[model samples]
Target: MRQPSSSAPPPAESLDAVQAALGAEHAAIWVYGLVSAFLPEQFEAPVGEGTTAHRARRDTTERLLADAGQTPRPPEPAYVAPQPVTDQASALAVLVVAESDTAVAWRAVLERTDDKALRTSALEALTGAAVRATRWRRAAGETPAARAFPGQPA
Candidate 1:
């Protein structure tokens, strides 16, 4: 039998945490574009709001990383959606996933950081993601639209 590797887990340092958040923000922004494409015409307002929110968060995360002397990860020119998003239902599903994933990244940052301001920011990000995910779930007609713990895996 092959032995398992014994490398140490990656450290949860501030710079690394911020970079992870930045990556999540980038992904969220990109996914919002995909979401907008398949959303119904009536959902233009929500899609626009989601896109603007994600962009703002991405910019803030990049600034935070740069201020800490860390290079922020850039967004991919394009991303493959986890599922087919050819209809409104699938687009809402993808939006829920994107928000949930972003929440998880922010939660990780919250777990790793002791700084008060960073903790506050992480909390806000997590809460915002949870709210967005819930809205998307409701729009998708999914049951139990809200999770007790937003970032933790189901």
Candidate 2:
């Protein structure tokens, strides 16, 4: 990738962190599309919401990278789920994992950046991921619907 203009001062570590989060968002959008097929009609609303949210975040993160003169990473053509999502149980399980991955990625951004605005945005994304994961867990009747410290490794 071409180096961003020196005047732009895009810190390599921070740019790398946001790029990782952007990739997670892309993967999330794709995962939601795939898992939606296995969800019930009642899940249509949340699924739609999740897809929309991820798209918005992805776009915003891309803009942030571009503003810093850094090239954003593109989405992959395909992603293999950690496991087969053939049923509602499996679908929810995969969704939870995807959302958790996003949370972790955003948290990495938070850790790498000193910019107040970027920190705020990363926190919002992280919180959103945590909430979405909790919702899926709730639907699956998993215990502890929310994590105490989301993005922290168990």
Best by TM-score: 2
Give lDDT tens digits, candidate 2, residues 1-154.
7555544454889999999999999999999999988999999999999999999999999999988877889999879999999999999999999999999999999999887888999999999999999999999999988999999866
Model 2 has how many clashing residue pairs? 0
TM-score of each: 0.89, 0.93
| lDDT, candidate 1, 92-118, per-residue tens | 888988999999999988888877788
* Cα distance off (Å), candidate 1, residue 37: 2.1
Candidate 2: 10-residue stretch with minimal lDDT: 1-10
Q: What is the C-alpha RMSD of each candidate to the true structure, in Å?
A: 8.5, 2.9
Kindly report which residue stretches of model 1 are placed more than 4 angstroms away from their true locations once superposed. 1-12
Residue pairs in clash, model 1: none
Each candidate's number of clashing pairs is: 0, 0
